[model samples]
Target: MSLVGIHGVSLRYGDRQVISRVSLQIETGEFFVIIGPNGAGKTTLLKALSGLHPLIEGDIQIRQRPIGDYTKKELARTLALVPQQVNADFPFTVAETVLMGRYPHLGLLAVEGKRDLELAEQAMEFTEVIHLAGRRLGQLSGGERQRVIIARAICQQSEILLLDEPTAFLDPAHQLRIMDLMERLRLREKITIVMVSHDLNLASTYADRLLLLKDGTVENIGTPREVLTREQLTKSYGCTLLVDENPLLGTPRVSLVSEKVAATISKDSGEL
Candidate 1:
């Protein structure tokens, strides 16, 4: 059975329907990525999978059990979410913040055990944030804070991890670092990763399969080569795009074609 089963799922914010009927299966240890333009409900879908949003139409299952059947603590122990943005204003130290991931497993008194501290330390070390363990969360840079958030999720020790735009606003090096770390974690810990991202090339490179969402509907779902076609992207994004193979990875590489460049190419081709 699939690790996650999303069948005919739909959600809304008040009267506005943000997610139309969508269905997909994520297998165990798969790196599945959801990508789409803004307002396409990528993050909302992730929220639905994480059980943060109520489904208006269908059901989500984890490990063949209905998601709604699980209590909050049970769900927390089953899945971990790292949101796109975090409130770094908290004065808590980095270690304290990461240790919070163990709350679901703590006793009724909500006290951290030695095992929780060890897991927090291991998570920080894995994410390379051990150096900043004593520093305040607000004192770190964007990249550092993001890594810290990821560390917290790691410390949670959940089987499935959900991330929303984890690489947004990060530098290229930092972006690569985060992606690599996620890949490593997935391979080493056998974790199932479900991530929402806007970077087409990054998704193509890392994802085992990609789901393209457009205006609250599923535009396409397949491997990178099948979903990242010029026609599909141009239609979904309402802009001209150039699709080519990446020489290094042999995967699809997408490039935006501005009107000016499109016109220039059209003119040059006409003259030939």
Candidate 2:
């Protein structure tokens, strides 16, 4: 059975319908990426899969069980999420924050045991945040804080990891670092990873499969080559885009056509 199954799922926030009649399957151990323009319902779809929002229609299943049937603790044990942004006002140390991931596994009124400590330490090491173990969360840089958040999720030890624009608001270098770390986790831990991103090239490079959304509906779903085509992207994104193969990696590369080129094309087509 697929690790995640969505059948005609829909979601709404008051009068605004965010997701509409979407269905898909995420196989075990696959690196699946969701990409779309702003307000495309990418984040909304992810939240539905994480069981954060009650669906207005259709059904979502995790491990063949209805998502609504899983209790909070049961869901936490099977899945972990790294959100796009976090605000830490409490001055907890990095290690302390990571250790919190073990809460799901602890008994009622129980403290973390030796196993929890070891797992937290290992997660810190794996996320390259061990050196910041003592630093206060509020004092860290954007990149450092992001890594610490991921370490906490790692310590959760879930088989499914969901990330929402994990590289948002970071420099180019930090973005690559986080994406690389995610790839490593997927390969070494053999976990299923689902990420939402706006960067087409990044998604094309790292994802085993791509899901494209537009206006609360699925526009395309397939390999990078299939979904990242010019026609599909242009239609979904509502812009003229130039799609070609990346010279270095041979993956789909997307670029915007300059106004001059666009005008030339329009003139040649007699649309001027």
Candidate 3:
């Protein structure tokens, strides 16, 4: 079954509708990425899928079942969310925070048991944050903290994962590392992964499919090479730009024109 389905999903805040009849699917084990500019409703869509925000219209399904059919615990078992930011002053140790992912499995008022600890430890190892396991959230660097957040999601052991701007605070290297870890995890665990990213290059390189949103609507959905093309992106983003093949991946990569080109053209026009 497809891991996720967003069918004719529309969302609104009071009178302002952010998305209109946006539809897409993420097949089982697919690495799906959503890309758009600020206020394009990428984050809002992710929130709706993660059940943080209720759908104002239409529906979202996971594993062929509507989201409303699942209880909180059941939903947690099916989908995990890695949010955008982590505060440095939260005070919880990295391990402790990750262990919280196992709460869905715990009974009421129960403490974390050996298996939970093991899972959290394993997640830390997978994220390469084991050494920082004891470090407080306030003590970790931006990248380190981001990894810890993903480790928590790993501990959730869900079939599908949702991440909202996960690389927001990290440097390029750390961003790549987190994305690489997600790719490896998907292969090893058969998890369907969906992420909202502003970095078009990384999104195209990592995602098996790309869902492009523009001004609260799904402009296109297809493989990265199809949706990230020069023309499609130009129309969606309202910017004229160049598209070229990524030398390594041989996929379409978007490139904006250099300012010098426009400057030179203007100078020539003035002379004319």
Give the winner by lDDT: 1 or 2.
1
Every model's TM-score: 0.97, 0.96, 0.94
Q: Model 1, range 1-272, lDDT digits (tens) per residue? A: 89999999999977889898899999999999999999999999999998899999999999889999999999999999999999987799999999999988987977998889999999999999999999999999999999999999999899999999999989999999999999999999999999999899889999999999998999999999999999899899998899999999999999988898888987888420
Worst 10 residues of 3 by lDDT: 263-272
Q: List, residue by residue over 165-218, the lDDT tens digit for candidate 3.
A: 888877889889999998999999998899999889999889999888888998
lDDT (tens digit, per residue) of candidate 2 on 1-272: 89999999999967899899999999999999999989989998998888898899999998889988998888988999999998789889999999989988888974999999999999999989999999999999999999999999999999999999999889999999999999999999998999999889899999999999988998889999999998888788788888989999999999988778878988898442
Quote the positional error of residue 138 for candidate 3 in Å.
0.7
| RMSD to truth, every model | 1.5, 1.8, 2.7
Looking at model 3, the pairs that clash are: none
**Candidate 2 to native Cα RMSD, angstroms:** 1.8
Q: Which portions of model 3 miss their true places by more than 4 Å?
A: 263-272
